[model samples]
Target chain A: MMGLLETAKISLRSLWANKMRSGLAILGVIIGVGAVIAMIAVGRGASLQIESHISSMGSNILIIVPGTTTSGGVRMGAGTQQSLSLDDAIAIEEECSAVSHVSPELSGVAQVVYGNRNWSTGVIGTTEGMMDVHNWSVSSGRFLTDQDVRSSTKVAVIGETVAYELFGSANPVGEIIRIKKVPFQVVGVLAPKGQSAFGSDQDDVIFVPVTTAQKRLFGTPFPRMVRRISVKARDAESIYLAQEQITALLRQRHRIGPNQDDDFTVRNLTQAMEAAQQSTQAMTLLLGAIASVSLLVGGIGIMNIMLVSVTERTREIGIRMAVGARPRDIRLQFLIEAFLLSVIGGIAGIALGALLSQTLVLLFDWSTSISPSSILLAFGFSGFVGVFFGFYPAYKASLMDPIEALRYE
Target chain B: MALIEAEGVRKVYRMDGVTVEALKGVTFSINEGEFVAIMGPSGSGKSTLMHILGCLDVPTSGRYLLGGVDVGSLSRDGLAGIRNSKIGFVFQGFNLLQRMSALENVELPMLYGGVPSRERAEKALAALKTVGLEERKGHRPNQLSGGQQQRVAIARALVNDPPLILADEPTGNLDTKTSVEVMELLVSLNEEHGKTIVLVTHEPDIASFSKRIIRVLDGSISSDEVVIKHDGIA
Candidate 1:
């Protein structure tokens, strides 16, 4: 039996003798592994970005929007019927055991003027519970207080983008900003949350007290009209229980019969986010599986080259056998040669794929995460490909008749 | 015991559904430290006999023994071990790997025998010195003359210090002058080292170098004769 290092040395020497053939043979492996790495990296990065966006909204969150309505045979979407109220949010917070916090929101797009600059942005009205429900914290000053909501104080908290646009690197706290021509003092600036999954800018918004928005800014004819209610469950596991409890409570409060659909829609954002994650994961696996076919094709290439090598080295095989190389030794020599080709190709592919991924990040701004497991999977898979593909040819070489092979021209 | 013994050995080759009898009921024996030459025409099965002796091929119906072990029942790997430790081969074409140096070619047999690297190198160098090619140990086959390559082959055959050496037209590719030189080298290996040698050749001049000459005719041994020492080492 040949030692491992000796077999490797012989294989390397033979490969070096046929440098061009060996290089071309391993090219397939290189491309296959590289493609697998790059595709998986992009998919993982996209999923991670989505998960961050979902968590930024809040953990274990549910958004309740007013149900659809119809006017003159035209059906409107959710939030069209203003059935959600601040009292319902308070009821959910007090009566639902799984509920952690609740915030009633009345939001609209409006032009906010500060000093001499005016910018059109989303304006949200809620209580101090808004910060808790949305997992948001102020970078400067304080969020709206419960007293501000109860007394209907004219105070606003600006998001990072709104602060940037209205203040231009200056502190905006204690300054007055006019929302819909109603003057409100800036109480805080929110820490930046970049973008939502819907591609809307999360930082380009302003927040005010819900009572002030309903009484002074919006001036709705209805007394307790609310557009949406955001709720947080006690923990991730209790989100469904919270949803069920809130649904029962709202159905009773609206006086809807058992046969009738409730007037409001409760959406579990956590469940929706989880479903999205599952789909993305499926897509990643699919992409990875498709890319793995290239590795098999690369294996076929190795087999083809190894067959040619066995034929080319027929005389050499005979000579080694006559000099006392056993069948296993001969087989191991060729196997090691194939393994070397694939492993070297795998390492090279990783380097190449990483370079390409970084280039994508720079040129196209596409996120790519090269995880360690993926690298290990790709490298180990390439080694398997080598052993699998190289076996037939190596076996053929080992089985050659020494007498006949020695006589071969 | 004889170094090699064969009794009623036969080799029949099947080619395209037709059987060709290469060796027919051949029987022979050679003692240790004896130099024997097998001589025949192209179709006389002398090469077939040489292959069987070298453990390169198994006979179809045979009782052959090498160093008191039955060779016919040996497995492929068993035969390989015998080839590594008990028998050495010298071929007409100087079958050296093109990429390896003379020293590496000489060390190959010992390597298969699992010799350590340091001792393998030392013994290979010593064998090369025996063949008077020690200075050309670093040269590849293409860089050496035909005679030097054959000397390298001889060094390779002697590296493991096998009891038996099998040569098949070892000097066939050489000029008359070089053939004499190689024959002399083999003669001295047998005479000075007490190594047993068996060689296949068609030329009477090559066969005359051995102590005993066996001539094969029609797949059977036709004549066997011992050279008289009266000629005083031809």
Candidate 2:
């Protein structure tokens, strides 16, 4: 057993002896670890973005809209028929076991006039339950009340974008806004939500009472008809049951047959959102796996160079053995040489990978997050690669008969 | 007391399924501070005998004792320890590590023996000074002449101050001028330093430098005789 400093000195000298060869080997490891880190960062970033997007859309949610209408054999698309209404929304919320909350909505795009500054945005009429259904909150003032909806009060809550547009930086809760020249008092501002998965600005809408939108703002032909209903289930796992319950209850209420076409469609956005999230997670795994292939190639490269170094230094081994070096000493010297290569390469690769991820964020506007665990994993794996590949070469050097090795050219 | 003893030592090699008796039964003993040479033709088993005596190889069926420790009973690592502390070797090729400095080359055995760095360096420099090459301690093997390289090898063999020093044709690659210089150095190491010296060479001029000569033929000693003392160098 050689002293620690002695082994280190020997390994360092050997590595320094052939700078070009050692550099090339270290470069292989650098590229390998770097690819693993950068690829995983990008994938993790995308998945996190999707996660936030899904959360903004709210979870365990179902949106039901009116089915198509056929006029003179000309079929219209979804939401053409005014089949879903305030009554159906109330019945489902009250009757369905899996259903927790519901908000019947009548939405229309209208020009809003506030203090002579005008902006056109979608205005949805709903009750206070809209906040519970969307998991939304008010940043200032208060949301639309049940009293406001029942009395058809012209009170409204604006979103951040609409508030910023009409009121600038000033608070808009105490201001009055007009929709179709019908004045409504601003009651509160919805908290800012950056973007939806559909790439739409979620902070660009307004909410008012359903009765007011049907009666005052955008008048409908039917008395209590609504355009859509957003329903929330008890929890994530009960969404399927909630969707089924909604369909069965609606079909029975609308007097539709089992085999016949229904007047409304119950759509589950949470399932689609979850599927998107799952695919992004898969993409993360896929990126890491692909990058690890390069790492494997790098390990093989290490083994190849080590074998060459052993063959080149056969005479050195013989000389050392002649000077009373044990077989373990010879084996350990070369093993340490390789271990140093990989450990140094691993550190450099981690730095390179982080830099690469930052570069991607800067140039491509891609979101990237470097997890510390990945760094640890990469470092540990690289060290393992070094020792693993170095073993055979070191073993071969140790097993050489000293007399024969001395005689080798 | 005998510092090195061999009794009926033998070595057999099986290469390509052909048995070759590298050494037949041979026996000898050398006391402390004695200088001897084993002289023979090529393939006459002089080198094989040297390897066994140096503990680099074990005898097939005999007893070899270094400092009264039975060599045949030792493990490979035990042999290594004995070689490190009790014996040193010098080869014809001046077997110094090519990339290492002369000082570092000399420090190798102590490095393996786990001697602390500061003391190892001091002892290695002292050994280099003994060979009169302390100033060339930093020079690599390629930077030195053949005689200077052999001196460096001798310094390396002496750094640990082993009781026994073995030279296997130490001057085989040197000129007559360099050969005489090396032989004189070995003579002084035995006379002044009280180191036991065993040399293997084919040239009678080289053999005469030792106090005794053992001649080998066909894997066995043909004759053993004393070398009459004279002006030994050259």
Best by lDDT: 1
The digit string of per-residue lDDT tens for model 2 on B68-96 reads: 99999987778788888888899999988
Q: Give me the overall lDDT of model 1.
A: 0.92
Enumerate the chain B TM-scores of all models: 0.97, 0.98
Docking class of 2: medium
- Write out fnat for all predictions, comma-separated: 0.64, 0.68
Per-residue C-alpha lDDT of model 1 across residues A278-368, encoded as one tens digit per residue: 8988988998898899988988999999999999989999999999998998999999999999999999989877887898899999988
Which sections of candidate 2 miss by over 4 Å?
none
- Write candidate 2's Cα lDDT for A1-409 as tens digits: 6876678888988899999999988888898899999988998899888888778877789999999999999999999999988999999999989988899999999999998799999999998889988978999999999899899999999999999889999989888999989999999999998888888999999999999999998888797999999999999889999989999999999999878998999999888878987998899899989988888788888888999999999988888888888999989998988888888888999999999999999999999989999899889888998999889999999998888888888
Candidate 2: lDDT of A86? 93
